[model samples]
Target: AVVSFTGVAVAVVSFTSIGVAVVSFSDGSVTVVSFSGVPVAVSFSRISVVAVSFNDIAVVVVSFASIGVAVVSFSDGSV
Candidate 1:
């Protein structure tokens, strides 16, 4: 799925069978909550960006001019 604002975009891709979740932003930043029941992975650029991942939980928050702040959370409580 894809969500977009004026100049920002958010995308999500999930694989339920393998328990994988991927979230991406427009600024070449990507956050993967979980992959095959492993850990979380996050990649971001620019300043004032925060990403957190644990077990099956992943959250990312970003702030920029004209972009405001974006927070995304993905979790299923399953390992």
Candidate 2:
């Protein structure tokens, strides 16, 4: 299964005895997996901007599993 938003996207997959899920945003993405009966989740994002521009990136993940991880990066260089 897959879901997508204007600036975001999500995906899910399950096979045999394993399952995986993924979610993506304008500046980030996330993935969740259930392997060997263990559940795990991971997410990451990166943003870069220049000049008089404002950039904001935020990520949130919720799960009822064994492990979850999230990462984000932002860089702004201007004169």
Candidate 3:
């Protein structure tokens, strides 16, 4: 589904059978909330990509600005 709020286009997809949820933003950003019982992954422009695995609720958030990159991951919801 999609919703336009304040002139910004936001999109959200339900969790599929493959167990992947996608959320997209107008500012060239994409977020994945699930991966077959895995965690979340997010990608941003000019930045990098994040992939979380091997744990429950382990979310990965990646941001790229000025060619710089950042990645965050959690194992077992701690560290």
Clashing pairs in 3: 47-64
Candidate 3 Cα misplacement greater than 4 A, ranges? 35-79
Q: Least accurate stretch of 10 residues (summed lDDT) in model 2?
A: 48-57
lDDT of 3 by residue, 1-79 (tens): 3334454344433334453546567776667666656444454444344555454343445444443434343433332
lDDT of each: 0.47, 0.27, 0.47
lDDT of 1 by residue, 1-79 (tens): 3345674454444434445555556666666555444343344443244445556454444444345555444445322
For candidate 1, report its TM-score.
Answer: 0.39
Deviation in Å, model 3, residue 10 alpha carbon: 1.6
- Candidate 1 lDDT score at position 45: 48
The CA root-mean-square deviation of candidate 1, after full C-alpha superposition on the true structure, stands at: 5.5
Our tally of clashes for model 1 stands at 0
For candidate 3, report its TM-score: 0.36
Residue-level lDDT for 22 in candidate 3? 61
After superposition, candidate 1 runs with Cα above 4 Å error: 13-15, 24-33, 36-41, 47-68, 77-79
Angstrom error at residue 37, model 3: 6.1
Better of 2 and 3 by lDDT: 3
TM-score of each: 0.39, 0.28, 0.36
